[model samples]
Target: MAFRDLAMAMVYFSQTLIGTVGNVLLLYHCSCLHFTKSKLRPTDLILKHLLVANSLVILFRGVPETMAAFGLKDFLSDLGCKLVLYVHRVGRGVSIGSTCLLSVFQVITISPRNSRWTDLKLTAPEYVSIISILCWILHMLLNTIVLMYVTDRRCHKNITYRKEFEYCSTIRQQKSRTILHAALLFLPDALCVGLMLWTSSSMISILYRHKLRMQHVRKTNFTQRSSPETKATKTIILLVSTFVCFYSLSSIFQALFTLYNNPDRFLVNVAAVVTGGYPTVSPFLLIKHFPCISNLTDCVRNKKTYNVKRIMQLS
Candidate 1:
């Protein structure tokens, strides 16, 4: 294998490994919260959906990209290509939708008790399940278009196409059809991203106002630990910011690949990396906020301290 191919393989393998582990761990944590009859927050419910979507995105997209990086050819059959691409698109849509839901829900959760959104705040949790289900169903239906165009690379080896997905090749369509299909695919994602941006801005405004009020009341230079709402808002902001940044980079690379007659191999690899970046990094961002992880660490620390004290007394 060429050194570039080997290096790309290693990078993708690492990304897949880390993302899989993080998602699985966090999923297990969420499962524990559910099964243990713990008081599950609305955010927790949304997070469970996000983690599952992230896992799918990482596995379906990352594994194939990794294999392709290793210079694997004809590794997937025609059916395999369709299934992989379809699932990856659905997973990615769900991931974006779930993030948007999380942000909007947080904004509702933190709104003032007398605000116009009070009714929404009270009822948002109840609709999370329904909304999530609709998101899944919508994406699943929307991405069926993939099954029509995608085929095993071997089947299309002789045909020229503007886009290539390494293991899969798309059957080029008429310009009008391509534009219509592109619009169908882009609209839903654009809507979700727009909502996320609006909600994020609202959150920042709310946080700023709260901070100013606190400063006026305290009249002190020392910083106080933020309230739970503040902390949660900050986490969601960070998560959304990370997603937008990575998604933008991935979209740019994808656009270049589509427009260029013969895109460079390096562009494809970088796009894959950027595409998977949000999934690989999001779990770690959330893990820090999981109470169970913190509790687990504290238990281990106390156990170690107890063991050391016992040894010292015996000595």
Candidate 2:
């Protein structure tokens, strides 16, 4: 393999490994909490969904791309190609949807009680699980259209097909039909991204106001230390910002690839890397702020204390 290919493969391999491990660890922690009957916040439930979606995105996208980068060929069957691409599309949609939902939830959470959103703030937690389930269903149904287009690269060598990935080829369609399909796929993602932008702006506004109020009341400089709400809001804002940046770059690369008559391997590789950026990075952001670490530490401390008490009693 060329140096460029080797480098790209290494990048994908690193992203896949780190992202998968981080998501799984956090997911396992969340599951343990659920099974142990620990109280979970509404945000926690949304986060669990996000983690699962991120894991799917990383695994399906990263693994295949890495293999392809390493000069693998015709490894997937037609069914395998369809399944991999379909799941990747669904996972990407769900990841976007989940992030949008999380932002909306945070905005509702931090809204002033006297505001018009009070009722939603009161009731949103009850519906988080339902909303997350609906997101998954919506994406699953929407991406079924992908199955009709995607096939293994080797399956259609004699026919004219657009090479979407190293292992996946998509049947070319009429211009109008292709446009329609593009619109159908783009609309939902656009809606979710728009929602995220709006919610993130609102959160920034709310945080600013809260900061001002705190500074006024305390008559001192607001330090790095902040309330849990402020910290959570900041984290979501950062998350949304990161998603928007990476998503926009990936979209631009994809558009260029589509418009060009013959896109280079570098363009395709860059797009794949940009596409996987959010999934690979977001998990670490979440893991840093996740309460699971503290919970685990507390459990260990309690266990040690109990053992010491037993030893004392025996002596």
Candidate 3:
């Protein structure tokens, strides 16, 4: 394999390992702890489901790309290509849907009773799972069209377009398909963005209210960290920030590609890097934010310190 391929393989392999291990640890931590014990106060069931979806994204998308980067494309026959791309798309869509629901739930939970979305907290969980399932189903249907376009055409005897290639379907057919994909993606994307903004605004209002109450209690400029609501707000804020960063980078790169006369492979790779980068970083960020993970790290550090101290005493 070429050096470029080796480098790409390394990147994918590293991302897969990091995402898988981080999310697995997070899932384990969430499972072991009582939901009430955590400041964030996520339902145990919801956390488990979210982690399962994240795990699917890493395993389905990350692992396949890693294998392809390593030049292991022989197994990627027509059927394999369809299966891989389909599962990856499904997983990606599910991630977006689940995260969006999580944001909306946070917003609704934090919103006052008089707020328009206050009732959503009651209905959100039930519908959120349905929405997630529907996301996977919708994307699966949309990308099945991809199977028609994706073919294993040989190039220079040992080269091809990375196991799958999008052929130019009839112009009408292609436009229709692209439009369908775009439309489905736009709804969720818009909802997620709007909910993120609303949730963030609501969180600010809640903080302000708390600030006012604290002032009456003679606390000056103090922030609220003791409440379960505040912690959940922080988690949603971080999740939204991660989504915005990745999605924004992807949009910028895509726009650049369309605006420029000829988008280079380097920029294309950059686009791919951004698109595939979120899963790699998200779990790590969650771990950093979660106190349980912080405790685990602290425990490890303390153990190391104790071992070193014992060695020093012996010496």
Candidate 4:
């Protein structure tokens, strides 16, 4: 391989490894909680689902690109290509749906007692399993077109039949089919985006009102008092924003690849990287925002602070 290709391969290898390990840790943490805890919190419910979705995304999306980066593009058979690409697409769709659910659930969970959604907080926990299963089935059905369209592009001497794949060919679609499926997929994506925006906005507004009320009641300088719910909201917001940013970036790059006859290999890699980037980074962000984790960090900081004091006393 050329120096550039080798470097790209290394980049992908490192990212995939990091992403895999991070997601595995997340999965392990959630699994332990699920099995050991008496009851799963709603937040944990969403998080566990998100972790599974992210792991699949990282595995399916990152592995192929990493292999391709190292110059092993033609290794997949037609059936293998179909299965890999189909699973990857389904994983991405599930991740999107899971994020939307998490965001909306947090908003509802934190809603004011008198608010319209207040009643949902009690009932939402019951529906989590059903909603998640529906999300899986819905996305699975929506993306089955991949099975029909994704074929091995490696040995195709006829370039016309080739579809776009992550490391290889993707689903070959004509203008009509492309437009139709895009519309179908966009309906859910658009719904998710809309729901996330509204829920996030509502939570922000609630926070603002809450702060003002606290200030009024105290009649003193406002200090930040964050609840566990607030922390979860922040985590959900960060995950949503990160997912949306990467999702858009990857889509734009993919679009550009289709538009241009000769697209840069670096751009392709960047797009592929963005595809797996959020799944890589989101677990760390989630861990960072957890109340227990933050408290543990604070304890460590305090221990260090005390150690410094002891050293000074000894001196």
Which residue pairs come into collision in candidate 4?
163-170, 164-169, 164-170, 165-169, 165-170
127-237: candidate 4 lDDT, tens digit per residue? 998899899999999998777666776655565645454355664567898779778877898799889888888888887887777876654434556777777787888
From the highest TM-score down, the ranking of the candidates is 2, 1, 4, 3
Better of 2 and 4 by TM-score: 2
Query: Which scores better on lDDT, 1 or 2?
Result: 1
Candidate number with greatest lDDT: 1
- Candidate 1 C-alpha lDDT tens digits along 152-212: 8678456666456677777877879988988999999889889999999999998888877
**How many steric clashes between backbone atoms does each model show?**
0, 0, 0, 5
Candidate 2 lDDT over 1-315, as tens digits, reads: 899889999999998998888788788778656655567899889988899899888999999999998999678999999899899999999999999999999999999999778999878998999999999999999899899878887773666647556767778777898789888889999999999999999999888887777776754446556878888888999999999999999889978877874578788888888888998888777765767654677644555666687789999
Whole-model lDDT, model 1: 0.86
RMSD to the native, candidate 1?
5.9
The CA lDDT at 165 in model 4 is: 47
Better of 3 and 4 by TM-score: 4
Per-prediction TM-score: 0.90, 0.90, 0.73, 0.86
lDDT (10s digit) by residue, model 3, range 1-315: 889878877877887788888888887677445422433344444555666767777787677666766766655555665566566666666666667667667777777788787667677666655665676676667556556544343323333223222211111134576567557656766676777777677777876886677766654335434566777677777777888889788878866753553466467556656766776676776675566676776545555666687789999
Badly placed stretches (over 4 Å) of model 3 are: 33-43, 73-75, 117-131, 155-173, 219-225, 254-264, 288-315
Count of clashing pairs, candidate 3: 0
